[model samples]
Target: MADEKERRHQHFLVVAYGAQSHVNPARVLAHRLARLGGADDGSILATLSVAVAAYCNMFPSLDATTDGVISYVPYSDGVDDVSLPRDIADRARRRRASSESLSGIVASFADRGQPVTCIMCTMVSPPVLDVAREHNIPLAIYWIQPATLLAIAYHYFHGYNELITSHANDPEYEVCLPGLTRPLQIRNFPSFFIDVSGTERAKAFIEVFQELFEYMDLWRPKVLVNTFEELEPNVLAEMKQHLDVFTVGPMVRSPMETQIHLFTHDNIDKESYMEWLRAHPDESVVYVSFGSLVKFSKHQIDEIVGGLRQCGRPYLLVLRRDGIEDDQSHSLVENTQSQGMVVDWCDQLEVLSHSAVGCFVSHCGWNSTIESVVSGVPIIGVPLMFDQPTNIYLAEKEWEVGIKVERNSDGVLTGKELARCIELVMGEGAEAKVIRERANVLKEIVQATSDTGGSAERSLRDFVKTIQES
Candidate 1:
């Protein structure tokens, strides 16, 4: 009976930071964990834990029991607000509250005969490690960004902080990191690396990462990256010498799978967007979105509008509700209706998979980058901050699947520049053809890793076996 019980079930908990980008990849990982042996195998169970605010946003009624496969559980961070606290005192309170709440949650699972076998956390949620240690459960980190970014962060905290700090102002200065084959320009590094401003947010980011890496050194948990060997072979090989790393990703969900949106959309008809796409010619429409977190300035918005209009292609733009002013919204829609459609939000994977979407104008968030790769759509990268620049570097410089828009002295990508990039990506030119073919080839490579008995599949199974034995 004990052996049967061991064979019948293993529970895995995935804790994610409460943002759309973080939560989406974490949820996808949970679903993949639940489907490990087969959907109905009953050998593995996966649960996703996020903050209460995010949970409420995804399920307005706050009635999420399970999303059919994986269970949904929310932990408290002291504040129930959508935005995280920026003040040091409030942030401390949130961490303490979350730590206590999550400890109780793990205990409750055990009380119900579902003791967690292993705990996996997304980036920036360091408290999960303490809880895992408290319960004596094995822990792993599900790195939701590219392997190159992970290498940069790991090296940044190790000993290269002072060197990079000294060259922060020199955007053109290149540095050769330990594992990467090519040197990266100072500008290509993550924004946090060069942000000399001692703002609370910036300082908080640095502190969190420092603590995460310190703990990683002490605990030595396995790091599961959301990239394949074929894409970042050298960096992956380099990272393995220092830490136990696993490549079980390109963790993108198929278009047929269900997706969770942590933000509410406007009352606009979502289906109308799909119907509109159907009306356009194949490989003719440009899709633009900058993910959920970026708040665009009005000047930037007007410039994007100008570029889309000048490009003269059928386009679909997803501008978040908070990104635009109410008075400007009406005129914004009126000015672009002839050649484009503006919606508050739509299904991103579904939109990318459509036959009409030829190119994606993106912020180069890791999720957006990987999804675009999976869908075989080339990119016009307008990277803003964080790991975005690094992602774009890989897309344009490393993968050659896209081009990054050039920003002016004032750090703004103007309408003219945006139009130029659109033309280069979508026009019938040799460069455009090369970019499109590379996108398709990378898509095939990523899809192959997720196939039956592929690299990602074998790595995931090995992880599960490690947990079961432990």
Candidate 2:
């Protein structure tokens, strides 16, 4: 068995971005790749994962979670704990160390009989790609963002900078970009593109995307995006013109497979939450989460409390500390008298799968978006930053799975407005019915695309074939 394995694909390394959001998808993809090694074909691929130290500390489960499918490795990035103060200097050190550590990984793997053949790095780790190129190891990028964001990045770096920038201030102003069917409002554009001079981190993401584009220009490599073909056909088609793009995702667990989580479950009566849903009528509860980041302001938290009270719905909200000083949201959650429960975190996918979950109040993170889509839950988008706005646009404008609530003149989403949006989605109205039906339809489509021998599976097979050929 060892000799046969040695004769085949040998090894494929998946480097994770370490954050819960990034690592979760990367690990799922790695699992698929590992499983592919056992296919009837006379090929084998040993999968290994490398995560940055910072997220490693946050999610120690990665160290013990693999069930002999993939090997987990950690690379130090100056600050092992993300809670530590990090700046440009720390980032530079992390990048340099990551590259060197990868070099060591390559040598170590080569020393073993199974040599590393390909490296698939999750988004935000260009240094991993550089190491792969330097080592002459074939590599692909696993883009976790939606194809719409990819299109936005492509156009932003290509030529549409002036048009996008001009409308940055006009939150209601809409702009048409290539590949997308609907016009994107200024509010729909990613905050970084609108606020180019916004923050150091935002600027850093621009630089990263710019560098990634440059690398792609140098070598138009394959990019494995975390979306199915049906979800974003136009954007995927247009992106394919530039590089070999494959839709190898909705890289998520099936409903039959137990839900995957990187963080510890908030020690709530986990079963009781599901039981609460079972007690409620179908499509009668609300699910809310901001996806591992973004602390809600006290004002925002208060508004949420108000909305839940006004809507008078059974709701589950994931309220984490998120390493911020602001305790108003947490405190208010503790004290608020709403007919709902708040967990620091919960089995989000499982909660979404519950028949009682009527609509999702989401931050529009890609993972949450896809999960909601798969679960057939309609959404109410409250996007904050990064790729969220674009996701909300897709949800509200493109897919019709959700609506984005309007902020007041003070730019606050008051309780009344929040209640209004929730009612709009969850109420027994024509629009709400339409959204639910569309969400259900999309859910079937997503499941079909993710089923065995489906779009996502075929894409993975093709990716494996590419590695074999290489």
Candidate 3:
């Protein structure tokens, strides 16, 4: 039993950044750590919730009793005025205002005599890096996105001879990366990267990617991606050649063939919505959602609505109408009234896992992209910002899992184009089946890698051991 006692002494300070997307994975890892060896074993698990309190809500999933392995520490938003883009300048002020709130986290860990030995942090949160440096802890930087995208980001920052210089305007131009099987277009990069040519936004975007790449060198955190080796062998292989790479995800549980229905919702009594989905019998239903955070202007939103109306196939859309003003705004709803369900948020995992969902219209965030692929749901990539466009390119071109959408100069997505894309994804001649079958194979590999003796589980166990020693 002395051995058990020794094991229980292993502790970690799992640090997380803002948003549910970033926090969820860390929580999953924490749960895995807490359950080490067995259910009754109480391993010393503690957390320093850094950067933003947005993650505080996810603490319940990690520790139901609220006493296990958790503490919230507010951090100074290190972004200065010089770093702010026109669109995000206000956000900088907010971060600066709350910078001091993170001081308590440092105090708590110091008081406990647990000088955090290892820091696990999501990418983009500078505060975690700051604290990890201050404490001299070996940090594990979680990418929370695909390795392919990270490679692209790295390549972009390194100025790799214009990966898509002339082809930026050509949709048909196949982009050939060092490890990818096929070429992708510059448009396949996230929308922000594609459109921001010489604008202030472009410079800011460059800065963010530069920061990410610099973090890669100076910090040298063990790189963690939300993918398995089988799905992205070429990209993963290329990445490992450069860094201390580790894979611990696709992060969600693998539903077996019989259990695929485990995540599907039958109680979605939005009968009207389901009825619309049923109207397109034998035809695949395209699922369009932009996730929770991104917002579209009224014109952009209406254009999307019109496009769906024109696409003429059945669609399930989750549209958050927040901040969209118009007493007459119901006019937008009335336009595409027949073909879609525009909810604020849907059970995305459950919806993706459903048998009926054929294609996803996504922002290409890692979590959503991984979930879509794992569920064998093809996608229509419409990236907003950050790693999303990179993810979209990988999904549509490299992974052969889906297609892409085009946006106009005014940033308006036309209804006719939307309709055409939807039809191409779900129509009779569509490669929807091929996409689904390929995705299933990817899912199988991820499940195998995340199981009891799989790479992710083992790597996580090793990490836990390191935490214990620290």
- Candidate with top lDDT is 1
lDDT of 3: 0.64
- Candidate 2 vs candidate 3: the TM-score winner is 2
lDDT per residue for candidate 2 within 1-470, as digits (tens), equals 96655557547788886666786787788778877767555255555455555435544555553456666666665455554326677778778877887788788778875588888787757678768878998878888998888888888889988888877788898788878897888888888889856677766777888888888778776789999888899988988887788898788765555544555664356775677678888898888887887766677777877788888888887787762347755777765554787777777778898888999998898988988998999989988888898898898888999999888888778889888999999888999999999999999998888777888888888987877776
In model 2, the Cα lDDT at residue 342 comes to: 75
Q: Write the per-residue lDDT of candidate 3 for residues 1-470, one digit (tens) a residue.
A: 97676546655566665565776566566555655656555455556464433433333233333434344443545542223335556555544443344435555665876445466777665555555665566777777777777677666656653655545566566666676666656656655445548777766556655666687787667777777777778888888887777777777643321111111223453445555555665336778878656767777777777787777656777765553554356456744555576655555676676666778888888878888877777788887776787787778766778888887777667777777777777666647666666777776776677678888888767656654554
Where does candidate 1 have its weakest 10-residue lDDT segment?
Answer: 325-334
Off by over 4 Å in 3: 1-8, 44-103, 110-115, 157-177, 182-184, 190-205, 208-212, 253-284, 310-313, 323-327, 334-339, 408-411, 465-470
Query: Can you write out model 1's per-residue Cα lDDT over 333-394, one digit (the tens) per residue?
Result: 64466699988788899999999999999999999999999899999999989999999999
Better of 1 and 3 by lDDT: 1
**What is the C-alpha local distance difference test score of each model?**
0.88, 0.78, 0.64
Per-candidate clash tally: 0, 0, 10
TM per candidate comes to 0.97, 0.92, 0.78
